[model samples]
Target chain A: MIVIGSESRGSVPNTSPNVRDMAQVSCCQLDEEEFRKCCLQLLQRSEELRDGWSWQQPQGSEDGYLKKTTLRCVSVTSKRSKKNQQDSALLIDSDCRQNQSAHVSAAPEEATDDADDEDVADDADVPACSACESSFLQFEYHVVFSCSYSSPVLYFRAFTLEGRSLTLEEVWSSIHPNFRLHLQENPLNAVSQQEHPLLGQPFFLLHPCRTEEFMKPLLQMAQQHHRSVNYVLSWLSIIGPVVGLHVPLQYFSTVCVKDPASSSNPG
Target chain B: MIMNNDKDVLRDVWFGRIPSCFTLNSDEVTEREAEPYYLMLPRVSYLTLVTDKVKKHFLKAMRTDEVEEMWFEYEGTPLKWHYPIGVLFDLHASASALPWSIIVHFKSFPDRDLLHCPTNSVIEAHFMSSIKEADVLKHKSQVVNDMQKKDHKQLWMGLQNDKFDQFWAMNRKLMEYSTEEGGFRYIPFRIYQTTGDKPFIQKLFRPVSPQGNPHTLCDLLKEMYPAALTNDGEQKRYQVLIHGIEPLLETPLQWLSEHLSHPDNFLHICIVPVPTD
Candidate 1:
């Protein structure tokens, strides 16, 4: 009933599971930089379809066959900063995303200078149609890369793949059947279009609050466990499809890699 | 302790024995394909559990920093920590079923993380089964000294007799020895064995329902063996007992789940016919 792992401060500990860090301690402990490097590796691997975070989408056939066009969690990133700005640059990235719909270069527009000092909420919340200048921003689940956290989050915006981004209707239709209800209720997945801290665009963010809970154990494993893991690939493998991004596994083996150094007895 | 290692008889299918049941696609992905985000859980969630070593490996494999509880759940119920994958598979005819699905919770991501793995996971199950097999082999043999054996017996008897107070009174002694492990805490695992089948070792922690209904062993049996209630019935009835003592028929499963949360506690199924007029 007490459910140990209280992280008791190493004194005359009340319970064995109650170490000072066990409850809060992560099994893996890579820092931000190290995590970034790991994610970077996976980002590249996912691009080449070398990592296992993606798979080929099968076609309808009498004779089974897999198409070369694979269904994978593509690691998407915006250029670093508004030339080192912040979420405001991400704002242009979102616009660039809209421009993508018109076959225009999605490069962050230079017009988006630091004039963002005004009430960002004045017109920022609504994504305007680049050509129309009146239509609101249509955010799609573009899926983003975070340099600081070195993790991939469910970033959404308008003008996704196939030129234009998924319309709200398309997004609603494409959402995983199981995740739809929770997507509505999960405060974490709630649609909060804002400027990305690094990309500076009005992208819909897959809330990171609840995400922290899941990452805690993973980080600890990176720190405590002996085997090296591709934290980004794992994160995408675990979180990508929430909005329907399917990443295939690269190493298609069924072996649990054991640390030759750490295995004796776990009693 | 009448262990039935179905692993031998039902091994090949798991090792790629083409079933006479259906033809397969050589190029296309099967029901169990390589998926990154989701894990495929077995239809029987309560059936199997991963070993700690593999649990660590699985966490590492995810390549995420999400905090994962060292436990896996099926429909929100955590599997007992001690269940070896083979034992769980045997209970569920897994060899024939081959490759049951696995469930991994994204612990920190409460809302979106809790998911039913879309594709059945091979690496997780393989890791679990292999680690368990290895652990079993490593011990080769165990000597629980006569004194400890007697102590264990008393504990078993207390369970058989349904003496909750007496059983726990002595359980502490066993736990004290393992406390130096990280801190003195209750061990994980609550196993249920039944006379219905000879040592069909299965573990599932059935938490109480919110409306206040304790899921009991009887409920589990009904769920596990649905055909037991025949439509052609002629006054056929059944009784459920734990250890040897009949538990209160309506005893909430939550009660059992809580009382037997420890790794050592076991509920062996011992069924017998009660006399009737």
Candidate 2:
């Protein structure tokens, strides 16, 4: 049964050509609380992925097929989308319900063992996690793949803000509010007609791991040397060839906070 | 003697020093022919100073021709110096004795290879000139004669209108500035090399508005010169100016800088020096 509801595109009136093509990850059947919770987890997952941590299964296991759970894919079919946008966001909800029904149905037919059902439930409860879904999506079929709802639709929109055409990153940040909204709204839509190459002007993506431990020293160093961390970090990225330093943003952030002068900041 | 690896060797020399004052305080100072004089404390990477008198006397005596070699006891261990003049002078004049300490100060130069070191206080020079009014008419005829050598379509497309003339004029102005007092001259040397291309080292440059005041320039320069520049809450306009432009940057900068007035225009003519021996 297809349930269609009123989906407001929100206050940002400008629509991205790519957005129409991006497969709409089914935001269906989820109540307000479930939707919110799913989004929160997605945001947290984005942070995790940004920090270089991969989603992986816990060790010492067997028959990983037992770990299989289904996720509902919502293909936002716009002519611009490159692939059918799959909604990994609804995978956990679907998989959990599927497993629950299976266990209920299987309980009566096979009176094999009490422990077996518990184990089956446990295996079935794999919850269609972010890492798993992403791995599955790596296969050609899944446009938007990932077990966990971390990797959302790749949304692309353009607007003139502050007298300049907003970059993809800037628009993403502005529309998403914080990382939470980004988790719920997978913006990268697949193109139905022509392949949309993801390329645009550069903008800063707020790193998930930014902590006081890192930024304080950096800010202090900036004040001392009278330089900005953004400038320094950007310079470091460019100068890597000349300076021969693998200055990733996280490392730069760490160095900045470690500066002694950072201690003087008013918290 | 030429210090093979000046920077690395200097670091070793500064950090690997013999502590004299602590030994004397422990009553471990043995009665020898020459007593230990003063301890050397570091003030900067290139300089150090003596802090104690006994270590100084020992260092002074060691420098003399009379004493071929002198032995002293520190921490109940016998130590001897054999004409270690450099260490002795460093100990006496200045060593490590600052708030941040010399080690911290020297930390800034690790990425700055020796090639960047200004060998002498001298300015280097370069010159380029645009064809004058007399040369322009003659140059046009010569251009027609040399049309076969040049890409006709490209040349015509580029010089279709007065825009090309404006560009030529602006380039002439830049050439003029480059030939002036503070301008590009010395090519960057490298610490190492794979091929001929030298890697570019990043140096920050303070932003100067067209009508920027001297005060603003100084402030911008202060932040720009540092390897790390951070934006404070206060309004500040500064940019990272890449050194040494490569052919790869041509199209990117054309799109990036837009008009010559944009900050991206400042990137042209930057020379990224290779950091090799």
Best by TM-score: 1
Q: lDDT by residue for model 1 over A237-258, one digit each (tens)? A: 6776665445555522311242
Stretches off by above 4 angstroms in model 2 are: A1-50, A53-77, A80-267, B1-166, B178-182, B185-277
Clashes of each: 73, 80
lDDT of 1 at B78: 40
lDDT (0-100) at residue A3 of candidate 2? 15
Each candidate's iRMS in angstroms? 20.7, 28.1
Over the stretch B1-277, how does candidate 1's per-residue lDDT look in tens digits?
1013522311221122111111111232233432323233221112223133334444554534433333344334343323333333333222243234435443422211122222223223222222222211111111112125455555555533435456555544332211322211211222333232122323222333334344555565565543333335455444333322355645554344323222233333333333354
Question: How far in Å is the alpha carbon of A11 misplaced in model 2?
Answer: 58
Cα lDDT of candidate 2 equals 0.24
Q: Tell me the TM-score of each prediction against the true structure.
A: 0.27, 0.18
